[model samples]
Each structure stands twice: as structure tokens, then as C-alpha cells.
Target: MANKNHSDGDLKGTFYLVMALGVFIVVVWGLCFGLFLDRF
Candidate 1:
């Protein structure tokens, strides 16, 4: 039972990390795209 709870916590942490990384990527991409439009 203890092990199961620990694994669940690990999974939740992994999920949050992936979500944060995805958001960071989208924000960076948006900034780059905006800069590209400004140049043209």
C-alpha cells in the first residue's frame, strides 16, 4: 500500500513537469513567431 501511494505521487510529479515544459515551449514559440512577423 505504501509503495502504491509513492508511485502515484511520482506519476503526478511527472505529469506536472511535462505540462510545464509544454507551456514553456509554446510561449517561446509564440515569441519567436512574433519576432519573425515583425522582421517581415
Candidate 2:
């Protein structure tokens, strides 16, 4: 039971980290794309 709880916590943390990273990548990509459009 204790191990199961510990693993659940780890999975939750990993999920949040992946989500944050995905959002960061999307924002950066959008900014770069906007800049490219403005330049061209």
C-alpha cells in the first residue's frame, strides 16, 4: 500500500512536469512563428 501511494505521487509529478514542458515549447514556437510572419 505504501509503495503504491509513493508511485502515484511520482506519476503525478511527472505528468505535471511533462505538461509544463509542452506548454513552454508551444509558447516559444508561437512567438517565433509570429516574428517570422512580421519579418516576411
Candidate 3:
């Protein structure tokens, strides 16, 4: 039972980590795109 709980916690942490990375990538992409548009 303890091992199962640890696995679940790891999975939740991994999911949140992935989500934060995805959001960071998206925000950076949008900022770059906006900067490119400003040049036109």
C-alpha cells in the first residue's frame, strides 16, 4: 500500500511538471511570434 501511494504521488508530480513545461513553451512561442509581428 505504501508503494502504491508513492507511485501515485510520482505520477501526479510528473503530470504537473509536464503541464508547467508545456505552458512555458507556449508562452515563449507566443512572445516570439508577437515580436516577429512587430517587425513587419
Candidate 4:
């Protein structure tokens, strides 16, 4: 039971990290796209 709980915690942490990274990338990509469009 302890091992299962630990694994669950790890899974949740990884999920949150991945989600944060995805949002960061999306924001960066949007900013880059906007800058590129502005140049035109």
C-alpha cells in the first residue's frame, strides 16, 4: 500500500510538470508567432 501511494504521487508530479511545460511552450510559441506576423 505504501509503494502504491508513492507511485501515485510520482505520477501526479510528472503529470503536473508535463502540463506546466506544455503551457510554457504554447505561450512561447504564441509570442513568437505574433512577432513574426508583426514583421510582415
lDDT value, candidate 3, whole model: 0.96
Candidate achieving higher TM-score, 3 or 4: 3
- Give stretches of model 2 more than 4 Å off: 1-7
Could you report the Cα RMSD, in angstroms, for every candidate shown?
2.2, 2.0, 2.3, 2.1
lDDT, residue 34, candidate 2: 97
A best-first ranking of the candidates according to their TM-score comes to: 2, 3, 4, 1
Question: Per-residue lDDT of 1-40 in model 3, one digit per residue for the tens?
Answer: 9999999988998899999999999999999999999996
Which digits, one per residue and each the tens of the lDDT, describe model 2 over residues 1-40?
A: 9999999988998899999999999999999999999995
Residue 9's lDDT in candidate 2: 88
The C-alpha lDDT values of all candidates are 0.96, 0.96, 0.96, 0.96
Residue pairs in clash, model 1: none
Candidate 3, residue 35: the lDDT equals: 98
TM-score of each: 0.71, 0.73, 0.73, 0.71
lDDT for residue 28 in candidate 1, whole number 0-100: 100
Worst lDDT run of 10 residues, candidate 2, spans 5-14
Error of 3 at 28 (Å): 0.2
